[model samples]
Target: MYLNLTPKQMVRLNLALAVLFSGVGVYGLQSDSLPISPYTCFTLAIACVVQAYYSTEKFVAKAALSNTITATDTSLTVKQVYYQCEKEEIVELSRISQLKVADNYLAVILDGNGQGYDFQIKGKAEAIIERLNEVLPKALLKNSPIKQV
Candidate 1:
């Protein structure tokens, strides 16, 4: 269930977080006592909490689920749960699709509606693509207009 991120991706994420948190902290310090006519202190407090979440690596996603895949009918259903690095909440996705792999991520295009969402799989993007392609039905691509690779 634990999907580990590649060291490169993790480093990039960490660097981004560092810059964002630093900016937030500096802004807070410089404008801490500034009075607001419309916004309340509660809003600023909430922003601080969000900034804190990004400052720590504890929020990075670690696991995802592969719930279902049906080969006979060329239909697949997969549910992937991920941690939203800053929000500290698990994002749950129930997707039924033909999988597509890209340079840095994988996209699951839904068959029924012709809609899809993308996931940035940490380290095993290529391997996951190969595995999904092997397991999913070939007929799933017959009617799909989107190109797969």
Candidate 2:
């Protein structure tokens, strides 16, 4: 089974804000009717640009990579953000000892190795849990309990 997770996205809104502020800045540069100085408008424009850039970067680096979870009979592959980049961890079905679901994140632990990978669930823990139950074996979750938030 494959699942595409929904993440809170605001790039459009941020870009829109940047454009609005940029228009105000350009107008301020061309006209002297407003009481505010042109420097203020320029500052606001620069600030907006920076905000848009960071928001876009964050969405791409963090949420974009964490966009899907794929499970097969052999393994479970999860897309997760690692450091400043995206990493895919493919754990064997038998290796996954536990699947922990939180309100906003899911953690998968590998047996013996104790290695863990966490992915953002974004308030869809229930859906993820359901999907896991369908693909994963019952024995793996015998010790794991679903916690309702």
Model 2 residue 141 CA deviation (Å) reads 2.8
What is the model-wide C-alpha lDDT for candidate 2?
A: 0.64
Residue 57 of model 2, lDDT score: 53
Candidate 1 lDDT (Cα, whole model)? Answer: 0.47
Give the TM-score comparing model 2 with the true structure, all chains together. 0.53
Q: Write the per-residue lDDT of candidate 2 for residues 1-149, one digit (tens) a residue.
A: 73342222345555666677777777888888878876776777677665555456554455532354667778887776544556677888777766678656778777746577877644467777776776665665676544444
lDDT of 1 by residue, 1-149 (tens): 74476645555655565565555555655685545422443455445555445334443333322322213343344333343531121212234545566544556665457577666544355555565656555554444323446
lDDT of each: 0.47, 0.64
Worst 10-residue lDDT window for candidate 2 reads 2-11
